[model samples]
Target: MAIYFYGCVTMDGYLADSQHRIDWLHQVGSVEDTGYDDFYKKMNVTIMGKRTFEEIQNLPDVEKFYQATENYVFTHEKELKVKNYQAVEENVLDFISKIDKDKNVFVIGGNSLIAPLLDADLFDHLIIQIAPVILGKGIPLFTQSEFQRFYHLDQVRQFGQFAELVFSRKAPLDLPIS
Candidate 1:
């Protein structure tokens, strides 16, 4: 099973503005029109940051996900509660690794959730939507520094002016040890 992340970013690479505003995103393209629907459908489990969970609560269909047995929000705020979301403060990877191997997991982010996973090299794939506009300052898609990594372009698709970039992590090739 593949554990991946999917979100729309600006041309300059931002998921939201300084104030955590994604209004600019809706100005250019909508979630339904974009490839998000298809990407979300394939995901059986969800792992997201607390800020992201807070942001998503405003969505009309947030209640729909309460049915999932595996919906987690990584946060230190033990008091933070969002209906059915399980608050996880332990090691993110340890929590993630325990999920059913048969299910495909989606790491939904406001950038905070995926940073450590990216650092630990736990993610297998990353699918990003590049919106047409740019936010000079905002939350970045990847928040890690000094962590070297590589990926192979798996696919690319266009939705209106937005571009969907799919990348699969390039596992290091095994070599002779002798």
Candidate 2:
């Protein structure tokens, strides 16, 4: 199974402003202007944090938006208000490992959830769409981590004012047997 991270970030590499607001994203462009629909079609399952799920809840017809995929929200809450999404309280790694091998999992948001998978070298792909505007201070897409991982740039595309970059995890080098 392949795990993907597909989202838009500010030019400064932030997911949202300091207030946990993504109002700036709306100012740049619309989903129709981006390649979101094309990417969404390939996913069989989606995983996100509570904050991301909450943000989706605010949008109209939240049920129909993610109707195609099996949704999982990483939250401590015993149950979620949404009908389609299932609440997950276990360790992220354990939960991810249990997903069917044939499923293509898309990570909606949450740097906290992304970082751990990245550190463990489990994230297979990263598709970041960079918006032209920069927020001086905001919630970043990445945080300090103890381990370092590498990826190779596979493709780059432009959708209006946004630049989309596609990266894939680099395969580990093979050592010759003595």
Candidate 3:
């Protein structure tokens, strides 16, 4: 499957603050400023870590926040009775590997969940909008990992005070849009 990550991070590379809050991102740019609507149009399913799901649930009118075709949450819990989300306790890599190769999976963040997938080289694309402000310390976009990976810059768009950077994995993933 074509796996992609979509998030807004600070210039310093943090996804959220120490409080698990992204108010800094909102302070600098609105949802449209991040081009989330356009990005979501290319995704069939969204995969997020449990903590990230919880954070979304805490938001006002959570149901509308992630209106994707399907939602999957990676959690340690074996059972989840949530109405709209499927809980996966299985290996994230294994789970993703089994999905249809043609499908586009959007990996939502919280850093910890992104590290393993990133380190394993499972992501096909990454679209991050850099907020104007920087929080010297907070939850980072990339977690601690030993391996190194790189992506080619496909496009960069500037919107007022924000900038959207889109990168695609090299070689096989650099094909032109169909």
> lDDT of each structure?
0.80, 0.90, 0.81
Alpha carbon lDDT of residue 110, candidate 1? 57
Prediction 3 TM-score vs. true? 0.87
- Model 1: per-residue lDDT, tens digit, 8-87? 88999998898887789879967767777667777888888877787877888777764554688888877554577878
Give the lDDT of residue 120 in candidate 1: 86
TM-scores of the candidates in the order shown? 0.86, 0.94, 0.87
Q: Pick the candidate with the highest TM-score.
A: 2
| Deviating ranges (above 4 Å) for candidate 1 | 65-69, 79-81, 174-178
Clashes counted in candidate 1 amount to 0
Tell me the tens digit of each residue's lDDT in model 2 across 62-137.
Answer: 8887888999999999998878999999988999999999999999999888888887788899999999988999
Q: Candidate 2 has which clashing residue pairs, if any? A: none
Candidate of highest lDDT: 2
Give the candidate order by descending lDDT: 2, 3, 1
